[model samples]
Target: MDVSKEAKESLLVLDKQDGNKVKAVSGIDDAGKLKTVPPRKEHEQDFLKIDKHSNILENFFSNFMRQVKDPTHFEFFKIKTDDVEKVAPVIETMATQKDTASQEMLNEYRVEPSDYHKEQQGYKPIDESRIDWDNLKQFGITREGLEKSNSLEPMLNYQKSPGLHRISATFDNVKVDTDARLAFRETEDGRIALAVHGVRKQPELDRPYFGNNFSAEDKHNLLTTGNLGRVLDMKLPNQEKPIPVFLSVDKLTNELVSVRADKIRIPNEIKGVTLDENQKAELRSGKAVLLDGMTAKSGKEFSAEVQVNADKRGIEFKFPENQRQTQRQENGSEFKIPQKLGGVELSDKQQNSLKDGGTIYIEGLTDRKGQQYNAYVKVNDKEQKLDFYRWNPDKAKEITPDNKSKTQVEVNSNGKTNEATKEQKEPLKQGQTQADEPQQQQNKPRGMKM
Candidate 1:
């Protein structure tokens, strides 16, 4: 009749029956005391073991499912199972459920399909025709390519699971310049011993200026002043051989020399002969001279002499009397003139001078006779004989047209005028007598009697 007491007693019996294997289930008893109902011995043992190994078994199953899901894994396994008959239906059902579950999860999370699979599916397949097959054959990718395909499953596995990926690093193509010297050596135990004298970037010259017993001043001048004249005799310690020493201008010049006893010592050669101040000054002052001259028809000739200075700046010309003529011509020719000189006109000279460097000097012109005139000159790249002084406005007007005219109109205040033509005055009418009409009487009909 008291079920709670009965249940408690039963639980106590079960607890005593199972040795450490039974899991105890607790509850409140009839007396309001905490009581546990222990499981059966066999069932307690099985449940306890399951609880202990649940995580391990779950992980193993997950890993196995992941392997089975990969397409590349199926290809690699090459299993002869009847996939269409046995596995297809299960896969279809699983895929449909997975898709529905994925959609539900995505809706709950508000995630996009693109975000889920972008990294795995976005890459485009390489077009084989577009790739340079000859280059691939030359480079060694064909056999290696097949090997990569075979390892696709492992590769995909590594990519999908962050925990399984492995990485490797390597370095190659080590080199050093000719002027540099390695300053450290590796020991057998993989430790490195650094040299007391570090690497230096410089050429080593064997010269007679650096001797073991030379004065410090001589060594300083040899290195700093680049003076190859100084020579010093050095005696080796272990032998009677005398070695000519040369000064070094390198970073590691303070270090000890590592020279062998049998090596031959040679003199340091000088680069080249250098010029002294006097010779250099002479070369600076020597240059070709360019002179310009102008001649007129009066047998008068004028020239400008430009003397180049020693600094190579410019040639300074003494302002000559002939320069005045050039200045006058430049000023006078500011506007085009219609006159002709020699046989050429001012228009021709204006065209020539404007094309050239602004000043045109006429040469070898002493006389101007009628229309025959000649003066030599250069304009731009062309040379011509021009008549410089003949500019006649009347001749220009004849060749072109004299269409330009001036008209005058006079206005007078009074009737009197001087130098007035007939056409300029107002005309008067011909005379007519006043008696031609009959007179009218006052008593008569004034409208009809006249």
Candidate 2:
């Protein structure tokens, strides 16, 4: 098993004697030597143990992943099964494939060759008398090493077991089960895909039928935990769409436990935004992160450079107010929508739109200091689609009293302003419809309601 360079760097090396306690960290030096550092008294333990004969790079990942508990750097979600009915079919396919794949692989990739014709056709023996043993010795090629080589001793020379065998892989302390935590990976298309971890069984089976020798506690854990395998692609019972979440393993108990998926969580998990380390640094410099995959009220997807919201305050997904719905063929390519904003609590209208993969345009959004603007929001939309029209701010019309010919207005009793009215301004261009006017909104009066 080849571990990725990132995973290798994230792991720490340990001695098995430390038990659950991480004693020291080890890594491969540039010279291909094992580098070890004793545990600092104040440092946290993260590495797993390694046996004396094991390769440092290969074994480090195997140990560290199994022993390390509750990863701090990663986000987790306490995901419960939403719709088991929607997930069962997927599980059945996975289970069937698991069995089918095992047999196919055993036949396709046998450790031993299928046919022994080459071995039966033995190679000509080396002429010992003509061979210069002293000269070979000078080059460190000893007769003992040569005799042990596979060329001199083939399986055809001896009677051995016939037929193919399937070799099951096992990891010490790592238990395989039907249930697993899913890790999300960002795809080239800007979508997030689920990468499962901590389990080896198919989604259909609640328990692993092969590979694992179960203990009493293992059996107990299997029965108690809920499986998310089937629901990875299904929408939550309450949410408008499916979300990717990760599960964490407990170091102390070696069990799957509830954790928050930081990426999708509210304020506490707002850091789950596409803001990586580099993006965070840029955000600190008052730069906006251009994120994608958000849908607008008109079923058009758009992207924007979102400003990083203050920490501790929750972020929001919203669309601007009174946005006209237009089909893609109507020369509407870009949706001037805010993908992520800072706020908490969705209005009833916004929640309803999010429920059905629809979009919401919320007018009169305010910050803590009473500043106002509008926003557009959508739910259950694709992550990274690029074929929509770009929003042209210059073409947007400022909504004012001059653009109020369509709506009837009521005057006050005193002939003074009874209702708040926008400033009267320029008239519409000849033959231009109201729809052709730009749709830019002005900040509402402090106490005015839409």
Q: Please give the CA lDDT of all the candidate structures.
A: 0.28, 0.31
lDDT of 2 by residue, 1-450 (tens): 222211211222222333322223434444543344434323322332322123442344333333345222221111112222233233333323548764443222111111111222233432354445565443333446444332223212221111111112234644222322222344687543333333332222344322223356444433433212111222356877554333222221234432223332221112112234565454333234455654333334555444322211112222223222222222132222233333435666555444443545544444322333344444312221111111212244332212222121111110112122333122222222232223323433358454
What TM-score would candidate 1 get against the native?
0.14
Off by over 4 Å in 1: 1-195, 198-211, 223-231, 252-450
Worst 10 residues of 2 by lDDT: 406-415
**Residue 177, candidate 2: how far off, in angstroms?**
67
- Candidates in order, TM-scores: namely 0.14, 0.17
Candidate 2 positional error at 56, Å: 39
Of candidate 1, the 10-residue stretch with the lowest lDDT total is: 400-409
RMSD of every prediction: 49.0, 30.9
Q: Can you write out model 1's per-residue Cα lDDT over 1-450, one digit (the tens) per residue?
A: 322221211111112222322223233344533233334433322221211111322332233333323322110000012121232233323323447774443232121222112223333333333334344343222424333334223222221110111111122533221111112233587443322233333323433323344355645543543322232345666757665433223222222232221221111110111223343333223222233443322223434433322111222222355464353343222223224433444567566554343434332222211211222332211111222222222233222111110001111111122332222323211111111122212222336342
